[model samples]
Target: MKQIFTLGTLAAACIIACAPAVADTATQPTASAGATSAASTSESRKLNKLADEYWDALARFDPVSAGESGDNRYADQIGMSIAPKNRAHQFALYRDYLKRLHTIRRDGLAQRDQTSYDILDYELTTALRFEPFPEHLLPLNQMDALPVTLANYSSGQQAQPLATVKDYRAYLNRLTQLGPWIDQAIANMREGMKTGVVQPKAVMVAALPQFKQLVAAKAEDSIYYTPVKNFPSGFSDADKKKLAAAYRSTIAGRLNPALKRLADFVEHDYLPACRTSTGWSALPHGMDWYLARVASQTTTDLQPEQIHQIGLKEVARIQGEYARIGPKMGYNGPASGLPTWVSEQAKYKPFKTEGEIIDVYRKLNAQLQTKLPALFSLRPKTPLDLRLEPELSRATASDHYTPPAADGSRPGVFWSVVNDPTEYGSTGMVTLFLHEGQPGHHFHIALMQELGLPDFRKFGGNNAFTEGWALYAETLGTEMGLYDKPEDWFGHLNDEMLRAVRLVVDTGMHAKGWTREQSIQYMRETLGYTEAAARNATERYMAWPAQALGYKIGALKIQELRARAEKELGPKFSLPKFHEIVLGEGTLPLALLEKKVDRWIAESK
Candidate 1:
């Protein structure tokens, strides 16, 4: 419903992209109503059409996302990146969609239709605001571990399949598009730099290895050729030969050269210019920009100062919980005063091999499943798994979660970085699983799709509500009885420390003008992270700026609300029903979420 900074020349193009409202979730957004103005119906229909266009476009935008979700429409369309022209077109569609959505008198629509329209408006506008900001251009970043996304395609278990002759061709097309995309990515980054919008120095360092891996000389040596070695059975020899040749040419002639260009630019030019500060505030209008992002992420009108204060309040409350547990564990303060106990904690060691690390997580995930029903009435229908973060992308990557496709073809995954397990700190596994796997991201995201809501809301998430949910899930271990064990309780504390530290350091860097070193130091002192992990997180902050601020600020709000509901509902409060209330509407702006929950609680009473 709100507008982002307009794209001047591309503004018209963006208007069309904006028209779809909620692309993935809104196709069947609402119940149809009888008797409306012909013009109003036409506009509503136009907005609805975006659901189809968005899937078609999204399948194009990220073929892996499409294939993983079992939408075979894009199954064969891989190897091509989004053409800027498509972006220009979508931009216009989105802008116009927003305009048309507003013109309708919302209350005139049926209840379901009205709600769908509200959600559609929010998702479309968020997409529009995000589009022209060069995010479309710089697709490869340290975040998703881009190189790993490629490696997983080769790994056979992930989204990009190794099934058909058609599948191989799909990848070839993907390879063909890589070089041009890289060029576009670099051009965009450079352009961003012109406006003081450069990535943090830490992120630039992370991008280097991806370039090096892709630029390798022989086609077989490249990760793309990996699947070529283990092709699916029953393929014709001639087709194999043809596929192999096409891949070799694409990798050697197109992909490798592009990598060389990017690597050379990164090591030789871009790194030097990367900003030393970790916050988005370093960019032009950076403060205003971060505030907008915070708003978008949380889906709320809370200002940065409000979120910051909320973060402080939540940190103190969590510390009290930690204090109650610390004496039982033989530690007194929330501060054992860093070094001695921090390093000496037995769980703070590394895995000897990558397999061991992956195995540990697999075991933990399985452990949780056996106990899940006692605490959660709602869970993901999708299966869950743990995988090693691919070696090629581990240097700059962190542990992450990738939710299953709506169709259930690909299982939700918890990927751990095996780059240097010692650096990762072993103590956080249980808490991490709850956040990324069990009651955290996987459940939240998967259920959004399962709910009978507009597709727009189904697939969309507010960062504050989403990540906040994960962080809050970390604390739920106690209620589930998992935290009765001292070690698991410690894991919860360690994770909370990480998020609380994020509040202090993320604010310190962007708001208070702390240097990158200062931010890293603050984390090291507070979070019990290794120096290396601290460095990685600080750099991530530099690139993403205020994104780190969302977790604690968000989780605290949910925890507070839950407490309020419990006291008010008293004997009548049902945890399962309460959870349904929290998740039932899908992710909303925090304010909307609170209002909706208040209504539910009042009616339940």
Candidate 2:
């Protein structure tokens, strides 16, 4: 959930999938170099140590990662913000580390270490881009930020443990940083304004409540009170009393007032004054900047127009598949217009209770696992579970993936509907399950973490590779035999169409200057979605302009690569090997992926 605030992209750092140990460094070339020259060996060890230090620094800033990895160096560190100055210092440290990493020759590392080094190098380079943009000027977006996350943290059943007074104190430290962070955010937004880079009015309006909620009403009622309310029985009375007072005072005096300032600035000052244009192209030299983003995210030099066209072709192909399912669902015409039929499917209606919806996904997961090995070879070790979005966030949240902690203590979680299940069409479940669950995110992400990749590769990722692989997994449903049900097969196609629509609409909004309503109308008319579904989906596109474009764009490149690999390898082609090659690389841009796949094909031949 990387948020596009007025300043920085709030790249919500999801927990990287966890592992059993320090990833068997005994096998790392730097750790065991019997054959390398002494100079190479010495340089190799130094580079490896720098790599470890990079992970340590990241985990320290990212409290969730530290807690998940079972690292106690930051155990008492909670609810803290990496100050703007500190963040700049962090960037400088990483730059210095990258220089050290480059000093070591790649030939000195093991095969595994080589891959780790390549991925780390990419992360360091990409991270350097953020330094140019002072994003801390505006940190918390209503859509995704600390306030929203803290509410989630307060729910007893999440990433951080809140059983002890120490945990409460950790949060207090983090929470206290908010006041200063918001001030910094304002400064950053002003900077953006100076450069004509402020967030779209739509984005700011959507985020207003986040500020209001964080600072709303009484201190006792704020979400920053779970530790005060749920302290462990063994806690001393003095610690408990003192922690409760911190929570109360922070919320009443500090948190609420900060929220008021932010909300008023957004709702009253920002939104009304927002730029009407949507695309990054609307900004000064935005076209070149967006092109860079496309290249960086997709890992390819493919032009935006080429991506736009691929989306068109895929949407049509999927639409044909949808037509076949329409009649079966009681529609009169070819199933091709299945979005309409899907909307009419009464059984697929929204749910009255959240528990019932979550339970059904859980059931589907169990049933699928029983059947998955028949078609797929990998699975996530993090126990997949269902959880509800916090009440405050439900209204804005979308179903999301929360990766397992570094210690494998928590399983990869597939968050379901933001609120009620009934809002989305029933036919979408198969496609949704395919993209987010089995053989999709769970397989690509979880399995990579298990393969002993460096921390950078495990925790940091590119959207195109990750999302593209999930969409590619959707087309594999027939191979798994689960799509034998016509409705389910149609469901998969509908999902594909949904992604295709994203490319057209996302490009239309940002690049083509299509209005928000126009995008909504286009999706509704073409995708067979209702007003609510259409609006929700479109707003998502508006909220994140280029991200939705990743799924179809990435998926097409992957499918194209597979066909080429199969054609080249011929009788040597192996699905498991193809999958292994794809997942084994962690996350690379689509173009980089093709290069890797081509190399794999050559090696297999």
- TM agreement with the true structure for every prediction: 0.84, 0.86
Judge candidate 1 at residue 285 and give its lDDT: 69
TM-score between model 2 and native: 0.86
Runs in model 1 lying further than 4 Å from the true structure: 1-47, 54-87, 103-105, 108-110, 128-141, 144-148, 193-195, 316-324, 332-340, 347-367, 387-397, 416-426
> Top model by TM-score, which number?
2
lDDT of 1 by residue, 1-605 (tens): 00111112112221112212232222224433444455346655655665445445544555544454344455544422334666666667667666766776564454455556666566566666655354443344564434445655665555565677877887677667667766876776677667666777778788677667666668889887886887777998998899888888888988888778888987887888877766667776667666656556555566666666665665566567666766766777654343336457765676677777778778877778877776668776777777777665465456777666665656777778777655455656788888987788877877777776555455444567778888988887877676767656777887787777777767677776778898777767665556887888887666555666667767877888888889999999887777777877677656656766677678778
Q: What residue runs in model 2 are displaced by over 4 Å at the alpha carbon? A: 1-40, 57-91, 129-142, 232-239, 333-337, 350-355, 390-392, 421-424, 530-532
RMSD (Cα, Å) for all candidates, in order, is 5.6, 5.2
Write down the lDDT that model 2 would get. Answer: 0.65
Q: How high is the lDDT of residue 530 in model 1?
A: 68
